[model samples]
Target: MIIKRVIRSQNRVIVEGKNLVKKHIKQGPGHEGGIFTVEAPFHASIVQVLDPVTGKPCKIGVKYLEDGTKVRVSRGIGASGSIIPRPEILKMRATPRPTVAGPKDTPNESCAGEDTRS
Candidate 1:
């Protein structure tokens, strides 16, 4: 009796594993004289799948055909707008502006200390 196995991929995104494994083998003697196997799957639900079209994580749906084959489909984005690093922007712009005295006039005594420090 032959027992067929159905194994789901563990990667969040589908990847060319054997080609990558071959590249790794050629790069170094590590895992020498042995075939590198892909990592085993955890629960499929635990992974967040990314859409290849748009660079974002998307909801996945599996559809079964009448011939008993499963096709994975990716649903599009949830919220629209790109994520911004607000704190980083604030930090970069947080520098204090220098107080401008008259063109010929010297800066105040407070700024005299600053000039000495530099």
Candidate 2:
């Protein structure tokens, strides 16, 4: 299975959404009291970064650019041993972007900030 993403890499690099084991837990202060699937750590030697273009698992190689700058190149088909651009990973918004809520055409025009709490 393809790795969704890498959580962390150290002595044991962790691969996300892999080898998950479900475990039950009682109601706790922080926890919501339910079963959760967590990623298990795997050996760093086994996991390898996939090729940028082909998306296939391949060994990484360093090649020099015309500017004399060394860059990583994917040794995959159609790659032609060319320098690969750094992958762009768009970060997800922690919270959804704030939206403006337009008026609902209520009976009164000045009731926009009226509190309806009991």
Candidate 3:
């Protein structure tokens, strides 16, 4: 199963096509009420990362390269010891950063009128 999201605080994950549940919604303002099928969160301990080389579930181990770059590798039983690359979703930001500063940001220039020596 593909992991859709990881909730660190709750130690749970949302996997695709797993732990499916039905949710009942009540009618409200600008909202429709009905039963909806949704994916429920499950403990991360139950899931294992699949090794790319062996295509089997295996325990993950951290390894550092000669250049001091850290990476995850498959270990333990049925392990291939292959480096696991980070998913593309993990590299993407939920909200993009603004290039221009907003009103809340302080001006880059220093206060010229303020006295320096006190």
TM-score of each: 0.24, 0.48, 0.59
For model 3, residues 6-110, the per-residue Cα lDDT tens digits are 998999999999999999999999999999999999998999889999898999899999999999999998798999998898679989999898998867675
Model 3 pairs in collision: none
RMSD of each: 19.2, 15.8, 7.4
Clashes of 2: 0
> lDDT per residue, candidate 1, 1-118, as tens digits?
1112224354333233311322234444554554555533234355454555565676766666689865666664562233222234335644666677667776577565465543
Question: Could you give the candidate ranking by TM-score, starting with the highest?
Answer: 3, 2, 1
Cα lDDT, all candidates? 0.47, 0.66, 0.91
Query: Which model scores highest in TM-score?
Result: 3
Cα misplacement distance, residue 3 of candidate 3 (Å): 2.2
- Tens-digit lDDT string for candidate 2 (1-118): 5555554446465566677778787898876888878877776679866666666677668888798987888785545555566555524554776465546544554677888889
- How many Å off is the CA of 9 in candidate 1? 17
Q: lDDT, candidate 3, residue 102?
A: 93
Candidate 1 Cα errors over 4 Å, as ranges: 1-47, 65-68, 76-118
Clash number by candidate, in order: 0, 0, 0
Which one wins by lDDT: 1 or 3?
3
**Cα error of candidate 1 at position 7, Å:** 17
For model 2, name the residue pairs that clash: none
lDDT of 2: 0.66
Error of 2 at 84 (Å): 2.7
